[model samples]
Target: MTNTPTHNRERSCIACGAKASKADLLRIVRTAEGISFDASGKLAGRGAYVCSPECFDKARTGRLSHALKTKVSNEEAQVVAQALQAHIQRA
Candidate 1:
């Protein structure tokens, strides 16, 4: 078999507009159910990336909902942020 170089997919943070490898950013998915933190980054829905909690805070205001093309309430955003924080702490 021919050897091939692995390619890292790059994505932009919705909050800061910073570019980075997909794995380096936290992913949030929006589906019919609602928006939620996507730790596995494999959820089937519209996804948005944020580089950090500070970025997430910025995004949660409006950027994230705009990126996802849905209305994300402040309460929903807070819940997702909490989940993301818990995940980060565990990691």
Candidate 2:
């Protein structure tokens, strides 16, 4: 007997390797310059998904700076955060 919802299926966090769900995580895209939030989830670029705001913060905290190949400025981080928050809210 199974009761778990399909929306809660597991997904990996690209930064910390955490398993979460499509509804519980946010996706970031690797642009030509760096990684940025892919709000549409259809952006044309490499992507890394994360489970929550904290992981996003950790990624912004130098761990993913090199992979992103660019600095994650506080202002830009705020943008990603805002977009993620909005997405979560709408869902």
- Clashes counted in candidate 2 amount to 0
Model 1 residue 80 distance off true place after TM-score fit, in angstroms:
0.5
What is candidate 2's lDDT per residue for 1-91, written digit by digit as tens?
9687876667688568887666566877778865678777678876667877777877776755655666777877788878777777787
TM-score of each: 0.89, 0.66
Model 1, position 15: C-alpha lDDT score = 83
Q: After superposition, how far is residue 34 of candidate 2 from its true place, in Å?
A: 5.6
Residue 37 of model 2 has an lDDT of 82
Best by TM-score: 1
Give candidates' CA RMSD values in order: 3.8, 4.1
lDDT of each: 0.90, 0.73
Predicted model with the maximum lDDT = 1
